[model samples]
Target: MRTEAIEAWTQLYAAVGLLAVICASCAALKTIVELRGGTVAFPHATWTQKFLWFPRLWLRFQLAYMSGFPCIMGIALLYAHYIGFAAFNPS
Candidate 1:
């Protein structure tokens, strides 16, 4: 039972760590592209225009991403705890 809980926790952390790495990579790529004066493509031209015109649009994106990361992490943590508990105390 203890081993099963440990395994579940390990898997959960591994998945969350992978997600964090992917998010960081995306942010870094965006910064690199912006620094090179390349436009980030949007599905719509209007959205692209807004991003180009606003200047702070990228900053907003980063801010939103940063805020969202914690919320997602929290949810993942809760879910992992629930699953781990369930495994140890199956009804």
Candidate 2:
């Protein structure tokens, strides 16, 4: 019973952490796009760069090179360690 309780709580914590990381990633991507002055072209990018690939590449670079990956990995590692702990002590 206690083991089941721990397993349930671990799953719940992981789920909450996963949601938070996703939200943070979206915010990070949006901020990166905004900082790079990427805009939604309704009619035209009269004064700005009019290449769709620029923003796409920029966001991809941000996700790959910036802190997003590490943050997600760290959260994953944390949950993994928690599960490991639970696994080795199933009392």
lDDT of 1: 0.66
Against the reference, the lDDT scores of all candidates come to 0.66, 0.61
Candidate 1 positional error at 25, Å: 0.4
RMSD values, in order shown = 8.8, 6.5
lDDT tens readout by residue for model 1, 25-81: 777666666656756443336776765654665674586458559756876878777
RMSD to the native, candidate 2? 6.5
TM-score of each: 0.51, 0.39
Over 1-91, each residue of candidate 2 has an lDDT whose tens digit, in order, gives 4767677567857766775668566866676675567553233355454555477656654654455656666776676576665553546
Q: What is the lDDT of residue 6 in candidate 1?
A: 68
Query: Which candidate tops lDDT?
Result: 1
